[model samples]
Target: MDTACGKEYECMLRITEEILLLILDTEQGNIRVSLPAHTRDIVIAGAVLMDLAMEDRIDTDLQQLILVNPIPLGDDFLDPTLADIANATDTHDTAYWIARTAERGEQIRQRAINRLAARGILETEGHGPVFFSRLVSRIRRYPSVDGTDMEDVHVRIMRVLFSQDIPDPRDALIVSLAASCGVFDSLLSGEERAQVRDRIDQVARLDLIGRTVAAALRQHTPSARSRKSARPHQQIPCVAGWPIAGHAFAMSRDLRIFLTRQYQRHGPIFRIKAFNRRFIVLAGPEANVFVTKAEHVHLRSNELWRDFDAATGSGRTVMSMDGPEHMRMRKVQAAGYSSKVIQNRLDDVIDITRRAIDTWPMDQAMSGFPALQRIVAEQIGLLLTSLSPQPYINDLTVFLETLLKIQVVHQWPKLMMHWPRFRQARRRVMELYAALLVAHQPENRRHRHSDFIDDLLELHRTDPQFLPETDLPVAFLGSYFAGLDTSASVCAFMLHVLLKHPELLARMTAEVDALFDRGTPTAQGLSELDVTHRIALETLRMYPIIPGLTRTVSNSFEFGGYLVPAGAQVIIGNTVAHHLPACFPHPERFDIDRYQRGRAEHRKPGAFAPFGVGRHRCLGSGFAEVQIAVTMATIVRETELVLERPHRPIDIKQMPLPHPAASFKIRQVRRRRASGTV
Candidate 1:
């Protein structure tokens, strides 16, 4: 019936009466897709697929597709063809291999049918069927997880039919993400839905494109099983049986171990899962494109805070706003903490650092981390215009090593928005800053002087739009909390590195000593020391700040020649990227010369971005660098450190641990040495 003709247009959804052949397709029934003329479009889905699948137990439905797409989109029916395609995925391959051992087993038969349809196993008019030899030839050209490694199953298939190559990984990944997004149809906005479709197209194109694709680009897993609560977040629906590896229950042991293992094995940007969200951890310069790129699809502070809340059970203590709102507040308030600006408070920084170091008893023999913590405390106070300017400086430098406990990490205050206590604590923290904010107003008599707070207050009064009520809490809370552990921990690591390698330390020391007298430390002297500058970069490369940073897609993102769906959480493994062969030459070797050496020009902008990238790039990067370099150089010039006792094995998971329950142990080696002297 032609609708254009205005006749009775019978939109026929043909329901054929037959013993419906419901083929169990993808592993664990994840990939179940219906053939065409079916009501649910492969592109569109409805209701909870698992609920419908289970309804079979109570209510009998005569006709069903069974499970076709292994990453089930809509419901109960599992079709064999697409499921086989998905089962060939990493997590499912073993099951597929074992199940298919029998001669033309049900699983294997369904697979051959789908692969034939997808790859033209038999001659058909729709695309144009090809013979088995053509299938072999097509197979040879297809992409797979380990493109280079021809697994036994693929080899058996090749030998069983004729020789054929592995299928493309991108093809598998596309089918996976597509089917994953198909669930929860009405909820996603029209634009977001389109973006997912566009990604499916891009991934399809990529799968058929070329060869030797990186694992981050090609390797992915879709979750096949269903959960009880079935939140929208879970229905993120893994496609192609892609690795939605582990979730809330399974996160503890596997997540951290998996991350470090990926770092050791895959370079960076491989996928990972945590608390039910699939995340890809990116690293090095390659990750910069996501963070610092013009595209602007990132996990804004508020989004990050949302996850933090999920983990912590609280929110709204600043660092949550995103896009123009975040930029507006930051622009108005940014000046107070700029490198040049923070430097004026350098007098404060120096005074605090000096007193903390000077008062230390030589015999105290503390860890480098403790000293770094003290420095961070000093920096925080200086940033805040610390009351009394001297006493609180020492104790405030807490080794927050305690904050990194796995239990605390899980109890993120923002997670339980429904909880009243969590909400109140957040309000209380914001209220504390609110009182301080009143004094920040230039017109307010309490803020007659031009401290950072006062300076921002003046700007707020001057610019009509600058007054975001949320700004005061965000800026101050952001600065205060940000400065504490990140800097201190890195400083400790850097000093420890220098102290361990005497020659490198001595070279750096000599450079710093030449700028001014042996022990006189200042920012100008630090600027003058090029060697010190070079070494600082090397130190960063070896032990970077924030092992990695996390981001979630506000909208869909196309990266590394693959389209990632909206709402998929991602972690840019900055440390792993730095260690990539493409980014750094001989990445494992810690040669300080890379930065200051002949190929010093090799260090590109986004390549070594420890402060991270995109719209959420670190605001305090320049400040942190100067602060670290000056402090480390100063300490080197003053005394040499000797590790009295080495630390127990460090937990890379809780890396960048700000404060430890106990201080590190090191003897101070003064220049005019007696026993522990330089």
Candidate 2:
């Protein structure tokens, strides 16, 4: 090795870093040279190609690597590689060069290692293992600085990848190369992997050199070529269903059972033909992490909910927005559900719950779902608009139900909206919203800082351009739609579960009793009700309101050994994932203690996604939890309740939001002791 050439290589540290990253597993503190001999060679060769592209020595546009500048820099490693490309008599593409150069991957790896050792960045040691009268030599490499043990350089590479700050092109290329080769799994911890997984995806999209290298590798590798030849949609195992109509009926009948069966047969990633369309279903925690944590650039939320546009109103709501637009709207809307705001409104929530409870016909057995629905609607109405639920609650409920039914139909025919009931209900709901908007104007101010509507109005006042007068009603409608059915269903599920299990109910009652005994039902008091909180979490796990979250892929990506193409509708089944034995053992058993300190089953990433996850995690999560806790605690403290039909199971309809298949009837036994006594 020439000392002058090694000195010249110091200026091209980017190439050295890329080679080191490829040949060394910084996380494991070992050289990856022992793997398939060609792996390191191919990656090093790919890095050289990337450096060439970056240096403008070569250019690529969709096909062949066109050499523009044949003149090479003085660096020994890069110059020789450049000569191979520049002096070739035969016209070869990028893939050909990578393959030809990769033949000497081992030589390249040894030279890079020797150079790093010469620079004192790495220490090499030789050891021999005696095997059957023969000695096998093993070379071990470790990071060293000035002959002292030092941290691996890969950590800095990962830090650059994970940091919010943009990395230089060289650092980006190195990280992108590792990610594109799927080396991250061996280099990152499970938690760290989850954190940087999306970031890696983002980097892959940004790094042209890395993508070019990946494309070249795919073209060269036989297996990768086969995979590329097969269409992404054809790769996934589609669940057996009807020819054209597909699994629409089965899906509607019981989505959880249908999906679970498909998951069992086809593994975590599968496709189901339903409503004359193919939906790629991704189950379990890994899928959840992929879908939720994926960059918005790759997976978009807007297209998934296109059917709901008419019902949700044009671009007026946050559901239609994505990326920065969604973030801005969420920031403004989040103010209403912030911890401070929710605490201040605790009294309002409890008062509305108490009033609704007072109205429930106590002695006679009555439907639990409708009563809970009305109560939650009223509570949300008060919290959002500071308005009574009197005339509008029924209309709002009717509107939501009609819209949900239409949504389930999946075919958004224009004629369906012309139906009498659907039209009437939608008209009634719009009229109510219009009335509310009229009453909430600046001139019609009664209680200026009363509720969520007031907050929106205030924002509109502050930034007229951002929150136009036309959008105020849309924002209110969006919040109403987001909060109403989901919260009500969760509260109803809690009641249904408690009524069925007397022991859990007794435990919760005792816990709530103890909580109020400490002080009045303040926000501070409610936060301390651990058992009550656990019950809420457990119910959400058992019956996730949304069941599954859907998104449309905007960029092609690999998942579970299959290429998921762009424009595919991907379903991350929260209900399916929640019930997985791997995620939550004995998942069917409704046990609140699963969430307790010693047994925090919900702590697992993606194990519990009742409110969805990532950028679009339910904005009203805090408000919903507070509302459910206050409602359940109040019920447990004020009344004694029993299941109306003990033998009958709670018939749950898992769509638009999980609700009872039929009304759940519960009988009130008697009034409980005062708040002070358990």
Candidate 3:
């Protein structure tokens, strides 16, 4: 091979450089001695395949890698690998080559390190006890004659991964390689990894080669092979009573109570035949960890919520999407609810809350649920659509309430949805949403301020594929549907909890008053109200609005000593987990202090599930938090509230949102004194 060809191979260090940096622990300045052998082999083998593709020596079409050139690349590390592929008599696929190459991964790894050492980019030393005889190396970044440190390569790669900069092909390949091997955690500290996780994930998706390699690994892994061969050992424990309708009626009546009773009888993992379908229910923190962390292929959200698709609409909202489509939509929607955007809208949120409070009758008793629902609906309207709920507030509230009911009892016969009253209500709600969409269009929009609608419009303008025109109305209604009822339920429950404990309410009131005395409620000021924030968190833990989350299992797996078969539906009950004596000690108590910095009781894994978890966690969590906190704080500071019927056990509705019964009433009187008075 000629020197120019050798130079070309030498300059193409895309794969090798990624492997070296990943294998090195930057803090310790040495090779990560704890790197597992199997993972290391898989990553190195993947790197070799990527390098070959980048060199134009090979290419893949769907299932197989076709050799494009048989000529030697003139680099010792790659030339032999190329030769092996060229000499193969049988037509081979990508996975076959990856496995074949991985058999010699240790040799490939050593040679790459030796090349780096020769270039003074790394220093090696004898490691382990004398008899063991192994080499340990540390990266060296000393400035070369060209005045560039070798370490700059690592920095440049990370910068490309973290920044919005469009990465060159090489850096994109590196990110794909790292993500495929699951080595991101090894390279970055937990905090640092979180900060750049989204960007890294975006970049990783760009590398088709890496994705193919990862898919191959998943298919051929020992676990996959064993799962394919093994049959489920025993039948999953099933809840008793109701064969045809199964446990559907009981589950819909009160999921928390039903699940808790089943848990007591069947332990952590059990099956409930519900709505003529079997659901595998997993409860507690261990179950939380297992379900949330399961592979996307093993469990999916869209399939679980399929029954509601007709009522909710299909392929038009975030909740209906799975995998890459869901992820892409989430990225676009995140812009509207980011901390910066929420902060910008904080004043509007506070003003809306204050207005709702002022309109409440001063002395007459009123059901807290409607008052809170009205306030929450108005606030969601202003923040999400930049529209006030004037002339249509009642209509909008009714629409949302009906939609929530339909979602909760969505399993009813298809004919029920087509009933005259139900269909009319559905049509009315869609018309209201359609009107909102039309009013917010670029040509028709009256308001100048930005909101979620504006953000989504911008996305649609820039990338038509990001959100289709048909989905515009559904997306808008979905955001409102998600926030309005859930927020109202939480706010009502908070009022109930506060009225039950006047002292606790007093402490929270003081905290809010102190913060507002400093200045108006800026995002920074609102965040400082630790007591109020804790109250919001504790309320959700005790009465999670959506008590249970369900998913469909795509791959069979073992959990809590039971084998959950593929194609089964799984339900994880947040209410059940929250009340576990093991998780929250005094399970029945409402202690806001549990979420205080020092206590942080909810920090225990799946103990708190108000916003759900993992990929399916509520997108509006930040929006929900800010909306809840500001509303609670404003009420505490501006009005003196007392339950009209005190000590009435809070009757929580079991289906839809865990709303307090309408009988829960409160009497409010405007504070006589000004800002700081409590």
TM-score of each: 0.54, 0.65, 0.67
Candidate whose TM-score is highest: 3
lDDT of candidate 3 over 467-500, digit per residue (tens): 7676676677666677666888888988888889
Candidate 2 lDDT over residue span 1-678, tens digit each: 001123333344446444564455332233442333345567777877776676667876447878878987765666777888888887777889888777666556556655665554543321100011011012222333334332344655766767877765666767777665656665666899888778887766666776777778766672343443434668688778887779888887777767767776778898887766778988877776665535354566787555556555544457656666665666566667655665777766666766666666767889888788777777776667766555766667666666666653363455676778777777777787877777777777755775678777777889887777666665776666766678878888899888888888888888888876765578888888887888899899887787676778888877788888898888776667778787788988887888877878877766777887655668788778888888888888888888888889888875556687555888887777543333
lDDT of model 3, residue 392: 57
How much does each candidate deviate from the true structure in C-alpha RMSD? Answer: 21.2, 16.5, 15.2
Candidate 2 ranges beyond 4 A from true positions: 1-231, 311-313, 407-414, 443-447, 458-470, 673-678
lDDT of each: 0.45, 0.69, 0.69
Q: How far is candidate 1 from the true structure (C-alpha RMSD, Å)?
A: 21.2
Find the 10 residues in a row with the least total lDDT in model 3.
Answer: 125-134
Instruction: Show model 1 residue runs off by greater than 4 Å.
Output: 1-270, 282-284, 298-301, 307-318, 345-347, 383-449, 459-471, 518-524, 601-606, 646-663, 669-678
**Model 3 ranges off by over 4 Å:** 1-234, 243-245, 312-314, 397-408, 411-413, 416-424, 443-449, 462-466, 670-678
lDDT of 3: 0.69
Q: Which residue pairs overlap in candidate 3's backbone?
A: none
Best by lDDT: 3
- The 10-residue segment with the lowest total lDDT in model 2: 128-137
